[model samples]
Every structure is written in structure tokens, then in C-alpha cells.
Target: MKRTLVIGDIHGGLKGLQQVLKRAKISEKDKLIFVGDYVDGWSDNASTIDFLIKISEKNNCIFIRGNHDYLLHKYLTKNDTNPMWVNHGGASSIKSYEHISEEKKQRHILFLDHLKNYYIDSENRLFVHAGFTNQNGIGNEFNPDMVYWDRTLWEMVCVMDPSSSKNNELYPKRLKNYSEIFIGHTPTTRIGKSTPQNFANVWNVDTGAAFKGCISVMDIVTKDFWQSDPVWRLYPDEKGRN
Candidate 1:
């Protein structure tokens, strides 16, 4: 079986991500899919983008756009002043590009623009940055907020919790299209601290790497999962040194 490796939010933790990939034993034949959030939170945003772009070019790698990625693209293109952007770990992303030339910045921006919102395979697995609404069908058109920051939808679908009120009736009716939906975005803590599960066939891989949690990678075919311990302190130096 062709192994499909789904990686969680990188959040610029290139070193940690490299170690995780090494541990996961990712091979050239394996299809690598990133759950997005490539920039911000960590010190190596520029290097992280460069690495992802190379992987995308060399092999079969799918990149999904996370909320942070959306914000970074906006900043790079329109130079928008979004305070929430900086608050949600965008400061580190800015710092990461401070030393880089304008040319490099443009390159990264272009790379982000090319990323897809989701990746669907023949095996009935849907790879998205966040997740689809269970109230709505998975075939529903992609909404930016739901695509980038829909934890409520994840909670509703992943846990099948009927207690929580549905905020947006605009969301999909249910997860009927795909057998499994992989997502990131909302921190796992917010998702209620627990390992990945198959509630309504929705799997959340965002182990909160940007906050106080691990970075996870799972092999879709083998169901093999690996994670790095919470490395929140890894960003204090800002020089990319451990």
C-alpha cells in the first residue's frame, strides 16, 4: 500500500519537524501531506517555507492552507496591519523574515499562494487545514473561517457532541463524503486533550505545536502515529538554536 504521511501544524518548528520526519521514516515513495500553519510561532519560518517548497517540488507533497498561512499571505501581499496576526504567533513569523531579502520574501509569498485548501485521495480520506461541518455535507464549498479556524465543527464532528449549539447553519450537514477527514487549526487542548480518534470519521492532527503540545505525524495507510514532546520552550532563543 502506498503510505500517505499526514503531518500536523509545523508552526515554524523546522528542527522538531525534521526530527519527527526522521522518526516517521518518510521515504521518497511516500506521499507527504502537510496540515499547514507552516509559518509563525517558531524562529525558522523562512527556512520552513524553503524546506516545504523543496519537498513539494521534489515529490508528491500536498500543502493545505491554515489560518496563520492565510494571514501570512495577506501580510506579504497587501501589507495589511492585523493585530490579531501578531497576537496569534505572527510576531515570530515577522522576525523570521526580518533578515531575509525582499526577493526571498516574495518567493515565500508565491509559495503560500499556490497551496491548496484541501486534498482528497481515492482512499476516501480528506486532508484539510481545519475540518468540514458535520451539520453540512463534506461536499460543501470551502469557507475560509471553517477552513482555517473551525474548532466547533471539529468538535461536533470528531466527538459527535450534540450538546454544543451550532453557531453557523451555513456549515455542512455531516461528514458523509469521505471516510476520514484530517485537520489541524484549533489547538488540541481546545479540542479537549486527547489522542486522535475516529469520531464520525474525523481525525484532528493538530497537537498544538504552536502552544504547549506535541507535533504529530500519522501514516494513513498503516495507522502508525508519532509525536514529539511539547517543545514550546524551543522558541525562546529565536536564533534557531536548541
Candidate 2:
């Protein structure tokens, strides 16, 4: 049977991504859901996006838009000169595109432009790069920034008791709409977890692939998972979160 695999923030750790995919035994038959952050950390932002574009053409794939991705989009489309973006690895992403052909750069911009904020699978599993805060549910009227940057949902999940009777009261109606939700903005390592971390009905899959952690891939149905070696090891000479 084919599996639905959800991967975490990539942060341009292309080699680490390869390792995790191999460890997960990924096949074309599998459906891959990437909780984004595809660019902006290691050195291969362009290559990482390129690989994702290629694989997406031949396999079942869902790419969620991440904050870094949105920043890049904003920069490309509006020439957004936010220093915050530049301070947080955006310069590295920009540097990655310096030598690429304009054609490929345009393709990457288009790819970013077309990315979805979230996806709901047949089983009602939510896949997003970050959390949504709209009390009305994941509708089109919601904030794009929230979809790619919110950490409150994860914070709620971390503190709420999943088995508690107050679960209903503790969760917003929008969040309650899914059986499970997968996200990848905040790294598990930020909370001292080096692997995919599960809290209540939310799963945080970003194991800090941009920094000292690794990439993670989880079987959406079974919850079984695979992880790559520490990504920093793969890029021994680069400073990641700059």
C-alpha cells in the first residue's frame, strides 16, 4: 500500500533531505506532503527548490508555503527590503540565486507564488507550514502571515492535555476541524526535541534541519518516522541561521 509521508522544514538542506527520503524508503507511489521552509538555510536554496519542482512533476506531492518562502515571494514581487527577512537567512537564499539563470529564477518565483498555505487530505489531516488562527476555520479570508508564521497553535498544543475533558474548550473551532494537524515552522529542537514531536493532535515535524538538527519524515497514517543525520554535519563549513 502506498503511504502518505509528511516531511518537515528543509531549510535548503538538500543532502539531509536525500538522507531522510532514503531512510523513509520513499517511492513514487507514496504521497509526499512537505511542510515548507524549502529555502533559506544551507547553501543549496536554488537546488533544493529545483529538486522539489522536479519531484513534484512526477509524484504525488503537496507543498505548503512557509514564512521564508513568503519572504522570498514578497522580495521578488514587491522588492520587499525587510531587514528581518535578511537577518533570518534570507540573504543566503538571495545569494543562492545569484549565479542561476534568470529563467530558473523566474521558475522558482513562480513555484513560490503557487504554493498553498495549507492542505487537508481525505482523512481530514491538516498540513501547514505554520498554524492558522482564524476562528472561522481554514477559509480563504484568513491571514497569510498567520498561516506561515503563527506559533500559538503549537504553544496551545504543548500545554493542553490531549486527554482532558476540556479539550473542546481549550481548542478553537477552526483547529477542532481536523483529526490531526502537521506543521513545520518551529523546530522540535527549539523545545529540546531532536525528533518529530507530538503534542495532542498536532505534530511538529521540523527537527531544525537548518541548524544543528536533522530532517524528519513521518508516515501520516501510522505515525512511524525516519530522520536524517544532523544537517549541520552535511554542511560542515556553512553558518546556517544567519
Candidate 3:
């Protein structure tokens, strides 16, 4: 049966991405939703983007904009040389782009330019790079930056008791109208795990592929997931996000 595979932040781990897809045994009919951060950290940023673009041509793919992706797009289009972006893995992306053809670079820029901040599937699952603020529900206005950079949504879930009396006061106010929410920006590794985590109806799938962990992909419906080899192992010769 066809399934929706919501992928986590890739961070230029091409081999990791390939491995996860292979493990998932993805078919042409399956829908692929990438949470975000397709570039930076690893050495194969350009190749990773190329692979994603090529895969989109053959399968159902939805690319969501990540904070890294946004920074890269800004750099490409406006020559943004923000140190924070560069220090936080953007340099690797720049190096990768320098080796590619100008035409390909332009195409990549366009690809990044068109990324969506969030996506709501037919099942009402909200797929976003980070989190969105919604007091009332889905119809509430959201800040795009928050949608791609917020951590409070997950933070609240981590601290507040799911069974606490506060559940009614917090959940409805923080989460929008979505059955489930899948996000990537904050790696689960920070919490000392290299696997997807679940809390208060939110799933964090970024297993730190850009650093020492592996890339991850989750089945939106079944919640089953797959991972690649440790990301640093994929490129032993390079200092990945060290």
C-alpha cells in the first residue's frame, strides 16, 4: 500500500538519505515529505539537493523550507554572508555549490526558493520544518519564521505532563487544528537519542544526520521509521559539522 514518508533534516548526507530510502523500500506511489534542512554540515550538500530534485521528478515529493534552507537561499540570491549561517554548516554548502555548474546552481536556488513553510496532508497531519503557533486552530494566522524556527512547541511538550490538568489549557492553545505534527529543526540527539521522538502529538524526526547521528524517515500513518548509517561514517575524510 502507498504511504507517506516524512523525512527528517538531511543536512547534506546523501549516502544517509539513500540508505534510508532504500531501507524504507519506497515505491513510486509513495508520497515523500522532507521536513527540511537538505543542505549544510555534510560534504555532499550539492549532491544531496541534486538527488532530491531528481527524485521529485519520479515520485510524489513535498519539500518544506528549513532554517538552513532559508539561509542558503538568502545567501544564493542576496549574497547573504551571515556568520551564524556560515558557522553553522552553511560553509560546507557553499563549498559544494562552488563545484557545481552555474546552471545547476540557479536551478538549486529556484528549488530552495519554492520551499513551503509547512504542509497539511489529507489526513490533517501537519508537516513543518519546526513548529507553528496557533491559539484557536488551523485557521489562526502563523508566523513563517516561527513555523521554521520555533522550539517552544516541543519544549512545552517535553516539560508539561501529558496527563496533567494543564493539558486542556496548553494543547488547544499551542497546537493548531492538526491530528499530528511532524517536525525536524531540533535534533533528537540533543535529548541524547538518535531516533524519532514523540511527545504531546508532536514527532521530532531529526536524528542529527548533520552531526554524529543518522538520517531518519518515518511513515506518517503507521509511525514506523527507518534510519541510515551514522552520518559521519558516510564521509570519514571530511570534518562534518565539527
Candidate 4:
């Protein structure tokens, strides 16, 4: 089987991402799949995008659109009408592009626009930025709002209680889509925690890398995981927590 490495939200931590990749020992023959949020938050959004673009051109790479990515694309394409965009890390993403030439900015926007919302491999593994919705039946087109903004799915899947299993039945078995769904956007305290119900094979790889944590990478086939130690520690909020 071809080894597939699925990366969580990068959040513009290029050095952290590099360390994760190096520790994971990614090889040229392996497929690299990004769950999105490549740019925004920390810094080096331009370099992050440029590096991913180069890797996509040279190797097998799948890029999915995260909420932040969608917001970034909106600003780049529509000149920023969405206020929610700014509140959700879009400001930093825009600042990342400020030093780039207009031509390059347009190129980046075009690239973001072309990214698919999800990717499914032949092995029945589904990869999406956020969780999918089952409203109006399953296999329906992914709702953009849910894709970019919904936290219900994470709540439904991430709770650590046996009762949470009941929530899994909300989606009809017919709509139980993929054998496994790889996702990002929800920052778990740990990486690759299975959903409350065993019915959905969900892997959440976002380890809060932007908030004094580490970036994570997981091998789909082997279930092996790797992460970097926090390289940049920012002061915590008034709550004194990330």
C-alpha cells in the first residue's frame, strides 16, 4: 500500500511543520495530504504556501480547504467583505500577503480557490478540513458553513463519555460515508483521538500548534504519529491557558 501522511492545520508555523515532517521522515514516494489552514496565525504564511505549492508540483500532495483557508480565499478574491474573516485569523493571513507582489497574491488566491473541500482515496478514507454534515441526507454536497464554521460536529465526536455514542446514530447508516475520516480544524489536546462512538473512524490531528503547542503528522496506513516540541512559546491569555 502507498504510505499516506496526513498533516493537520499548519497555522503558518513553517519551522514547526518542517520539524514534524522531518521527524516523520516523509519520503518522496509517500503521499502528503494537508488538512488545511496552511497560512495564518503564527507567521510565514507566504513561505508556507510557496513550499506546499512546490511540493504539490513535484510530488503527490492533496490539499483540503480549512475554514481559515476559505476565509483567506474570500478576502483575496472578493476584497474582504466578511467581518467574521478578520475575527478568525484572516487578518494575519492578509498581512502575510502584504509584502508579496500583486501578481503573486493573485496566484495564491487562484491556488486556494482551486482547492477541493475534501479528498477520498480508493481505500475509503475520507479527508476533509472540518466535519461533514448529514442534513438533507448523507452524501449531499458539503455545507459550506458547516465546513468552515461548525463546532457541533467536533463536540459530538470529541466528548469523552459513553452516552456520546448515541449521537453517532444521528446520521443514517446509509450516510456513514467513509471507512475513516481524517480531519483538522478542531484542536484536540492530543492528536488522533478516536470519536466517542466507534462507528465513525475520525482522526483529529490538530494539536493546537499555533497556541504554544506542536504541529502533528499521522500515517494513515500505519497509524504512526509524529510531532514537534513547541518551538515558539507565546504568553497565554488572562486564563493562563492555551
Candidate 5:
């Protein structure tokens, strides 16, 4: 049987990403859904993109756009080296491209440019980099930028009454539109977790690979997950997104 896997924020930890894939025993038959933040934080920003692009060519993959990814794309294509971005992981990403050929850099740019803001699978499961604010759901989202930048959806679900039924009046209409929602951006580590976290019908897969935590991948249907060693251990010499 084919497995559908949902991956969390990578944050340029190519080692973590590779470890998880090996642990997961990934095959061509498996479908990979990446929740983004593929670049920035660690030193392998360019190398990570190269690996992703190469793997995508041979395996089924859906890549979502993350806020950091947008920043990287802006820096690459428009020269918008925003200071805030630089202070928060963008500096590493910028440095990673310093030695790349212009042609390869352009290919990476195209890859970032084409990342999806959000994706809804055949199972009516929504996969997005962050969260959407549209109470009516992603289809009715007004701000395209908000889809990958909003934290309201995650914040809402995180505090929801887990026992509340869907029929409850307080249940969020946005979540009701989909069977389940998978998101990254806000790391589970914030809540003292280094594993995939589920609250209500939404799952937060970002285990903080950008920081001290590990990278995680989950079999969405089975709820079985695999994680790499802590990213800080993977790159002991660098302070990744700390």
C-alpha cells in the first residue's frame, strides 16, 4: 500500500531530512507532502533545495510555501534583503547561494516561485505551511499571503476543547470544511514537544528542526511518525535558527 507522508519544517537541515527519509524507508510508491521552510537556519540551505528538487523529480511530492521561503525567493529574485529576514535565518540562506552558478540559482528560484500556498488532498485533508484565517476555509481565503503567514488557525486549534463535538457552536467553521488539517510554521517545541502534535482535528508537524529539536515525518493516515536526531546535533558548529 502506498503511504502518504506529511513532513514538517526542514529549515535547511539536510541531514535531518535525510535521516528521517531513511528511517521512514521511503519508496517511489510513497507520496511526500512537505510543509515548507526548506531553507534558512542551517548552512545547507542551497544543498537542501538541490536535494529536494532532485528527490521531487523521482518521487511524488507536494511542496507548500513557507514564510522563510518567500523571503528567500524575494532575496534571490528581487534583491530584497530585508534586515528582519537576515536576522532570522535569511543570512545563512543568502550565504549558501554565494558560490552557486547563476543557472543553478535560477533553477532554485523557479522551485521556490512555484511552491503552493496550500494543498487539499483527495481525502479532504488540508496541508499548508502555516495556517489560513478564512473562517469559511481555504477556498474562500482572501489574502493569498495570509495562507502561509497566518498563525490564527493554529492558535485557535491549539486551545480548542478537544472533547468538543463538531456540532458544537464554538467549533471553528474553518476546520469543519476539511476532514483534517496539517500545518507547520509554529514548532511543536513551543509546547515542549519534539514530535507531531494533534489538537482537535488539526495536526502540527513542525517539531522545531530549525532550533534544538528534530525533524519529523508522519504517516498521515496511520499517525505513525519518524524523527531525526536534534538538528543542533546534526550541525554542532552552527547555531541554527536559535
Candidate 6:
């Protein structure tokens, strides 16, 4: 059956990404939606981008922009190496590209430049790298940065009163905008979960592939999912974003 798969944050773990893809039995017939942060952790940053670019040629995919992707774009296209970024796996991303050809680097830049801020599928499922703050919904977002940086949406959902009806005035209007929301920026590992998690209608697929956890991909319709081995095991020698 045709399926729409929502992928979680990769964080340069090309091996883990591959594992999940294969384990999930993904095919060209299925639509793949990457939630983002494809770089800036493991040693495979450049390779990860190359793989994504190459795979996109044969598979239907939607690439959403994440905070790390935007940061890497700044460094690649503008030479901005913000210290905080360097501290947060940016150095690893830079190292990965050190041996790459300028031609490939340019291609990577193009890929990064075209990443979408968010995607709403035909079923009204919202897919974004992070959270959006506008209670009125993503279409009316007041700040563009909020789409890729806000954590309030996820935080709110995590603490929301699940029994409250959408019609309740005290309920969050943001959650009411879509049938379901898929995001990645906030890893479920942070909350002590090493698997895809759902709170209200928001599903956080980021299982912390940037850290010691694994990568995840979920069939949005059936809610069935697949995961890779812990990323730390895949790149045992590296600290990744730990």
C-alpha cells in the first residue's frame, strides 16, 4: 500500500538513517518527509547530505529546515561559525566537509537553501522541524523564526490536559489547526523516551539520533514505526552531540 512516512532528525547519522529506511521497507511509492537537522553530529555530515540529495532523485521526499540546517547554511554560504554552534556539533559538521570538493559543497548548499520551513499534507497533517508559536496556526505565524525554533508548541502539548475538548475555550488553538502535527527538533530522548512519542495530536519522531539514542521513521497513517540501533553504537568512537 502507498504510505506517507515521516522521518525524524538525522543529525548526520547516515548509517542510522540507512538502517531505518531499510527496516521500514521504504520504496519510491511511499512519500518520505524528513523533519530535519540532517547534519551536525556524527562523522557523516557531508555523506548524509550527499545521500539525501542522491536518494531524493528517486524517492518522493519533502525536506524541512531545522535549526542546525540553517546554522550550517550560514557557515557554508556566509562563513559564519558562531561559537555556540561549534560547541554544539558544528565542528563535527565542518570537519565532515573538509575533504569534500567545492562542487559537492555547492550542491549541498543548494540542497540546504531549498529546505522548506513547514509542510501541511492533504490530510491537514502539519510537518515542521520545530514548533510554531502562533495560536492561530502556522499560516498566521507572527515570527518566521518561530516555525523552526519555537518549543512552546511541543511543550504545551506535553503538558496539556488530554481530556479537554478542542471546543473548550481553555484548549490550545494551535493544536486545533491541523488533524495531526509531526515535529523533530525536540528529541523524545530528552524526556527519557527512546522511541517516537505522541502527546495530543503532535508526534515527536526525533529519538535523539544526535545523541546516544536512535533514528526513527513512522508511517503517519498506520502509526507503525521503525528505528535504528542506538547512534552511539553506530559511531562508537565519536561523542556525537552527547
Candidates' TM-scores? 0.86, 0.94, 0.94, 0.82, 0.98, 0.98
**What TM-score number comes out for model 5?**
0.98
Every candidate's lDDT: 0.76, 0.87, 0.87, 0.71, 0.93, 0.93
Model 6, position 121, has a per-residue lDDT of 89
Full-model lDDT, candidate 2: 0.87
lDDT by residue (1-242, candidate 1, tens digit) is 55889999888888778878888877788889998998787787889999988877766999998988989888888887599888777887877777889898889988988888788889878888876654455457565456676666676665555444335454344665666788888767665673444455677788777777778899886678988766565555553212
Summarize candidate 2's per-residue lDDT along 53-145 as a digit string, tens digits.
999987899999999998888877787869998888888888887798979888989999889989988888889888977766666535666
At residue 20, what lDDT does model 5 achieve? 92
Question: Residue 81 lDDT in model 5?
Answer: 94
Instruction: Give the lowest summed-lDDT range of ten residues in model 1.
Output: 162-171
- Candidate 5 residues 35-108, lDDT tens each? 99998999999999999999998899999999999999999999999999999999999999999999999999
Model 3 regions more than 4 Å off: 137-142, 164-167, 170-172
Q: Against the true structure, candidate 5 has what lDDT? A: 0.93
lDDT of each residue in 1-242, candidate 3, tens digit only: 89899999999999999999999999999999999999999988989889999999999999999999999999888989899999999999889888788899899988998899888888788888888666664346455577788887777777766775434655455554677889999989999998999987889999999889999999988899999999899899988786
Candidate 6 residue-wise lDDT, 16-44, digit = tens: 99998999999889899999999999999
Question: What is the number of backbone collisions in each predicted candidate, taken in the order shown?
Answer: 9, 0, 0, 0, 0, 0
User: 147 in model 3: Cα distance from truth in Å?
Assistant: 1.2
Better of 1 and 5 by lDDT: 5
Q: lDDT of model 6 at residue 148?
A: 84
Comparison by TM-score, 1 against 6, better one: 6
In angstroms, give how far residue 31 of model 3 lies from its true place.
Answer: 0.4
Model 6 alpha-carbon drift over 4 Å, by segment: none
